[model samples]
Target: MTPTIALLLIITFLLSTVGLLVLIWSISTNQFSNSQNAARTIFTPGEEGHSEDPAREDTSAYKGDSKAAKEAFTARRVQDQSSKPAVLIWLSSAVFWLLIGSFYGLLASIKMHYPEFMADSQWWTFGRIRPMHLNAVVYGWSSMAGIGAVLFLVPRLFKTPLRGTPYAVTGAIIWNIGVILGLGAINFGLSDGQEWLEFPWQVDFLFVLGGALCAVPLLLTCARRTVEHLYVSSWYFLAALVWFPFLFFIANVPKVFPGATGATVNWWFAHNVLGLWVTPLGIGIAYYIIPKILGRPIISYKLSLIGFWSLALFYSQVGIHHLIGGPIPTWLVTLSIVHSVMMSIPVITVAINHHGTMWGSFGRIKESPTLRFVWIGALMYTATSLQGSLMALRSVNVITHFTHYTIAHAHLGMYAFLSFILFGAIYFIMPRLTDREWPWRRMISLHFWLVAIGILIYFVSLTTAGWLQGLALLDAKTPFLEIVQMTIPYLQARSLGGGLMVAGHIVFVVHFIFMLSRRGAMTQGPTLFRVRTKEISQ
Candidate 1:
């Protein structure tokens, strides 16, 4: 085996050993029990039975007029009237970008089927349109939607009204405009030609401006929070808020660094944006949804802290793994590979914390749309990180670099993990926002299955096809054209998967619109899978 491949195997073994040890520890500590009590906690209303301590009692001292504690609790439960306008602005921007991104995906899929579909238009060329598709999906749809959710969720999680609501609205507008102009400029043959940072230097200023605007609401919400205990979700959101703008500004500075160092910095920023920005949002949603649905405190607050800090430390340095075998220095690649392998420390900690928390609640997975989506997303987080670490190994990179395998990895992380978690978040948030339950439970069930199966088809086909192509390229006898031809069948399979996923997205959009219009059925409890009448009787 090549040194890179051998190193990857060693890392895999180490992660597996660590996971086994964790499982053993959990069992010994009685943390491995089923979490059935937790799942019923959400529906248990009032502070009587659910109070953390039984000794606390209602007294005249606590009920005194104009008391600070009472005022704080009231403030926590009340929604801010001013925040609605800002949330709507953010939501509208997110939805518009979602549609544009879907269309770009559709166009890109068509080009795969017919390479010369838009031969006459320079702006429609494959290279230009490909990056546009990526930017549209990542920056336009995902980032916008994530921010909208954050605008809504951060305040709710913190139990406080958003501060500077108007600035938040302004930021959403600016962000939307920036994305549009950046995409337009790139499609119109103006670009820096960097992989993920394709937009020109001038356009980046708008992003910085918009990012500054967003920081205002987040900072204010944090300051105004009534909840004494900061939940794991809040931690992730706060970290992401601090991380994104700093990385964005540093990465977009033009010609500030020398040749290969620039490339190294760019990739570092690119990969971390995924880890710091998108990954945190997804993980935060999971942390909230799993516990909220199960109605339990997180399995172990200490474990979560370990996972969070480990991820922050390890992920920041692993981006150099992407540059392995490139013109970059050898030590940089080795350091990255080491960091990538060490990432398992965080990945396993998070997996244990999330999965272990659900130990006895597996039955609910069948009934709760939010739980099902979030669970799958949580699992995929582990899978994708493992795959990423393996790919970082020099030997694996030699085979997988520039192939569809990398494409498969990206989709697994972005679509399967992050998007799935977001879908769950939407399901959870919509009811709270609209004061009505979902109109169609069956549609949600269908949405879950379609996307799940679509991801399976997408990942399997492309990964197998990519591996074969890579091996063929390595073999001197196989011609390059034959390798290209082999990928067509896999690409066709990918389009099929994309079709299913898009169909599910359409279902979700319609469902969201129905809920927004208040056309859905009214219900007292959450729109859960199982009807648990009197299960948690007050």
Candidate 2:
């Protein structure tokens, strides 16, 4: 809005334009001419982490390769891939954060309905609690879990063992420290005072350092991979690894951009952390786990290629859409909206690949908890992406921008979509990691259904209430008090939903701890949802 801010925005836009031009140039050079080669990594030389029969030795597709190479590959794959102590350590940390964050979320939701419940203590104030809860969930549970999942996946995909387990453990320790320091800073009101960027700038360097340390071995693993073709999941994994730190440092750098343009940077960082960082991580993990469980290659694997590139191309520019009616230029906002709608191209292509992969094999969904959870996430991904594109429209934005509609939309993507994917990833990976099965079928079922029902209630109620709230705001004659009164019922409903979710999280934590301790009656086989025999047989 000011001269300085406008100038900063122009510079930012120009830099982005130059970056896009270079990307187009890379595309023109035929760098992406080999989808076949990339997809072939799924059938890497001697991976035996397959077969429904636990007792069966690998009858890998690459039998023609030399015995020595097979021996070396198998040695690498089994030696430390599933055996590493660090994997469990990181997972345990992730689970701790997931539980704590959900607890924080429950507290925040309570404050929303009953603001005076803890008004006496600034430490427990809503203002401080809300941001802390967000940071905990987004960075703590989601990002850590995502990293843990990919750590398990990369070795399996690359046909290699993880190196530097101690380094990763160190990184996790420092990362947790950074998060704690940041949370403390925020609660003390010594924050950057923006939504996702509230983590104090003083502590930002620790996270960057910690992330870099963790990334070192993962990047080395990418270089050390023996497979001829990098799988599509690897592509997603590599991009997210690179995208997140870069986004974090650039977006959080103090004194880099001034005033209102800083707000642009703030939002751009926050939303892209979702789109470019975690979204790719979830998609990459899904791309691997889905077909692996089905014992088949992804249907129309070429479509996966389209979706990957389109997402990379389209998503980075989309965060600006949140600034549609804000202090920025009209043209930039217009450009962002166009990109948001264009995002549907990637979303639809991904949906086609995902849904089509499971099209006739729908019954497989009934047989594997991994399949059901991941498949539900895939469906939610489609819904959330299309909803996002629609919400980017000016007519839609005018109604939903500042309302609970945005909150509902965010939960749809983050909780319903991403968390579901992460949940399923853990289920699939833990068996391989622990060499055991989920101990209780009922807990698994309860976890799935309770969270599913709670999120549905939370999303639908808030969405409906938000639309009405936004409409009321637009109606100049309507009193603001009436709008506040109207939201009370929906807020109460949200608290109920949040409580159900808390119960589910507790159930899942208990089950996860049982799995870790190797306690209780272990499942003798792959746990799956009950379905008709004919459908499963087909």
Q: What are the per-residue Cα lDDT tens digits for candidate 2 across 231-288?
A: 8888898899899999999998888888779878877888799889999988888888
Predicted structure 2: lDDT: 0.79
Q: How far is candidate 2 from the true structure (C-alpha RMSD, Å)?
A: 5.0
Pick the TM-score winner. 2
Please give the distance, in angstroms, between residue 24's alpha carbon in candidate 1 and its true position after superposition: 28
Q: Which stretches of candidate 2 lie over 4 Å from their true place?
A: 1-37, 44-83, 520-538
lDDT of 1 by residue, 1-538 (tens): 3787788779879977987898799779865344433323222233212211101111111111235534543443345233566766776566566667766775676688678888688888887888888898888878877877777777757777888887888888788888999999889999888888988879888888887898898898789776655677778889999999889889988989778999899889989989889998888778867766665666776777778878987898888877778898786788889989999998998899889887887987777787788888999999999899899887888888878898899999998898888777677666555546778888888888888898888899889888888888888898898899989988888888877877777777787788778897664432222222323321
C-alpha lDDT (0 to 100) for residue 239 of candidate 1 = 95
Model number with the top lDDT: 2
* Each model's lDDT: 0.75, 0.79
In model 1, the clashing pairs are 34-360, 35-360, 38-294, 39-294
Q: After best superposition, candidate 1 residue 478: deviation in angstroms?
A: 1.6
